[model samples]
Target: MDMTLKDLRIHKGLTQIEASRICNIPLRTYKRIESSVTYLNNPKYQYAFELLDKYVVNKNNECSFNSALVIGAGYVGLSISVLLSQYLDVTVIDINKDKVDCVNNREPLFKDKDIEDYFKNKRLRLTASLPNKELYKDKDIIIIAIPTDFNKETGLLDTSGISNLVKEIRTINKHSLIVIKSTCYVGFTDSLNDKNVMFSPEFLREGHALHDNLYPSRIIIGGDKNNKKVKEYAKLMQSCSLNRAKTLYMSTKEAEAVKLFSNTYLAMRVAYFNELDSFAMNHDIDAKSIVEGVSLDPRIGDYYNNPSFGYGGYCLPKDTDSLITQMKSISNSELISSISHSNQSRKEMIAGDIINRLNGHGVVGIYSIQSKKDSDNKRYAAILDIVSLLKDRNINVIYYQPHEMSLDDFKKQSDIILVNRYHPLLEDVKEKVYTRDLFLRD
Candidate 1:
């Protein structure tokens, strides 16, 4: 199939404005070239395409392994499958029939726009099926991206999802190079004692999984660096990405710690900003200005500088807690240990402030239970905890059901609306809305 200018741009991980800047074309002209076939036939097309060609992934270069078996149709698994499927044939297996059907129907299981566009336009050599022993045979590589839910009882990750599946896949196919992309505890790969097993942690955000894969910050191969498969797999991922990403090879245990530490650091940053915002609120100072001023330092970048109720997404809360658990056995980790507690206190303070706003009596309408705007994922959103705290205080909470409750009706029904991230839809009811989102970009 002939690649369109849009396809090349997306694969190159360049925004329209960036592509325009590189090709010395106007942004409007670039958009027209990408959107219209007639405009794409113009002379501008050749210049733009040729300029961007070197930056895009070259699918012409073939790999040794043509087909891959990916376990779990979750974010990481699905993104990797789509990335490799651009050049290699990939089959994804999930126990969830709904996810399998969605993949087969070219429907995205989540809210990633890149995945949606790829499903609609790109003929990715990808398929999905339910887990079976017969399907696991003869695959070049197998990736495990299942959820490693935090076990509060044990104070560690419940990685049985990965452990059990690895054993099962080994029973079916011992030769396939199995890669562990799931978040695992330290020594997880060592615990398996299998030569083929390796742990390569995924470091992508919730909604932008596929885009991050295409332009990864770093490609890490966590296993015996000298192993032939490990080196080849690194080359495969490097070739598939938009740019030449630096690759790191380390022991699986170090890789496991890298995932935990990286996420814990992010959670720490979130906690830091939330605490700063809390202090600002206590003193009635301008939080945004203080945050912006402090973020001027290059080390303290403004990426995760936005403050909210707390860091309660899929990774931050659980990973921080798990790391704290790991630190308990050591002699000193007081700094690393305080992140979860700070998060909890922030939530309580926010809840208390909300109650003060209500004067201890009012119905609260939730704009969204999701952590971020335009996402269906609510795994551990802070709003849910806030709602629970409100319920404990005898406050009624109602959700914005667009199909049933009209916006005006929803606004009228509640004395206050609790939104973690502000949306324009609630502009009419701004007085009734309560949000801590100062920077407005989630």
Candidate 2:
């Protein structure tokens, strides 16, 4: 049944101004479209339809609580914000004004297919704003998903951001549960010593964050299982999840250990496989053939074994380094430290091999700085280190930037092009391309 635009607007429970603001249409423009019979005849009608593809659902009151606030609008923060907003009100705040604006406009801060879909069609009681104390107070739960970058100088995770935020939150809101989702140094959560402050580490991939949250592998909430607040928050998370993920309760320190150790173990696997690939390359054997043969073992499995430049991303690099530093107290195993050492050696080996292939003097071009084909995130990418190594050897290296230079020009200028991941765009110049991507999957 075709209804008038006014009737449709009323059905969606939006006032004229509210509809205009949420849809990003000017107030005056919306009013004209509503009353004018020429709306279908005018071009403005098409724009209005596109905006109405999604509508805002305000102040959802379905879950354990009505309100939650997430700190840091980066990958972790924004992903969880979109996930939790389905069941309750969620306000995502960040220091960056542009990121905040992006969230408020219902635009993705980064590329995630699930998040993009949810933003357009799902019932999201989500908002984004600058960091405000008033927004922090009165929320049932305050999730701290801010970055705790590993500080090279201090040899510790720079948790000053989380520490200061906790201090501030305690001063204003005493009842709300403050959940720490940021990756931290082992025992960093217990070091805070606040019963209200709990640590729950997120085990999400780089590009597939929200999808993982919806179907989480496990939900580990660190604190006393007996505590009402702890149980309530756990319930809140389970309610949001599509799968009934196993919920594990443990000490804050143990939960912290789980996150660090898990990532370190994955890094170790990467280093292990990368070392194997290095061996295969050294012997001039088919790397993929050997990889497939070894992966045939049932116990070893056939996952996360794709060879690359090295395992260099936000979680693996930072968490492995932090874990290596944290493990210095009791266990002094050279093996744990060597995971990072192995990665370094692998990059150096790769750089040397590339230079040797160039026969000492030639301009080398880099295809992309990103570790993955789809991802734009370049945090701690392995290519950066390789570039540094090449520069030290007096090798002239150029990067293929889409905006500054054309693809054909980039291909034409360099004697040999280095890519961490292979792409079809460079297929025409196959012999000139160099990469370790065996399976051609990220």
Candidate 3:
């Protein structure tokens, strides 16, 4: 089969318009090129490959890699490894033994639906402990997908993991192009001064991480242009992506800033809606009705306007907090900081309200701590703030969902349930329960 430019571009997940913009050509011209009628003679097409490296695990067919090693078993790492396994011999390395074992057994670590199939067919090799340096020592690419959590006290991500990992990679495998998928502050990759280093931001949501990887919104790759390795790395990454999304290449610091600012803006939007809901709630006004009316305007749109206690997730809370702290020299991010502060206040108020509603100290049952309805995770869940607040007031905060905790005695001792969202079995304790889930939906 004669592979047309459109076929290659589409397999790489690029729309004609996106291809045009990436190639710096007219949309009409790009369309004809993607339609296979014209050969893509534009030099800008090379830029797309660099951007594709930011999002895709392996380039489609441009680069030859005998084996690939991915560190970290978290959602981003797992997703990247699975995608790469489709085209290359891929092995996942993580410090967590259970996570590696689970992946080896075809078990879903997080709530991803597509992970099992990736494992069942023996596509990706999963392993605990460090990847054998002698084995991946010759691999073309070694991706760092480890968690870089923001320290609550320092207002910066604890990139010690990344730093150490990079040092190890440099010591063990100096030639492998190191792609950092973990989110970090702006100029993070620049500080390391590694010509092979590239900052690729992950845009995957918690529950739909793999699916998002399968059909990404866009791919971005950023590093210094002087580094030929970075350019080749980007090309390899673009070749591996879904092949239909647009890939944009820029500098490393710009990629880092894009990740932080993107999340901060989302936190700002969440805060905006929560503030609106709080206003409606205090005045005994119908929040949903008012929100519906406001969202009907085409300019504003309707999605992501739902009011919640606050924005608390693995990504939003730390990213916003980190961005706020990183704004020491910059003066423009005050509004973003306020959005994060507003979320904290909302959580405090929700806890206070629940506490005040209770007549006496009883076993106050805490429902699913996961902010969203369908998720099984509770790390950085907003409900934990409620737990802390109520505990300070001498209320017994008994957690019912063991999915988030190791405590086994929780189910046996709770008289009053505090659920953010309601369920049918909660009817028995309905009179004693206190919740802000007025509409019974997330």
TM-scores, in order shown?
0.89, 0.85, 0.80
* Top lDDT prediction, candidate number: 1
Report the Cα lDDT for residue 108, model 3: 85
Candidate 3 residues 106-156, lDDT tens each?
788887666665566434544444555665587778888988898877778
Question: Candidate 2, residues 220-296: lDDT per residue as tens digits?
Answer: 99987887888888877765555568899999989999998999999999899899999999999999999899999
Error of 1 at 8 (Å): 5.8
| lDDT scores in order | 0.87, 0.85, 0.74
Clashing pairs in 1: none
lDDT of 1 at 52: 76
Q: Evaluate model 1: give its lDDT.
A: 0.87
Question: How many pairs in model 3 have backbone atoms within 3 A of each other, for residues 3 or more apart or on separate chains, i.e. clashes?
Answer: 15
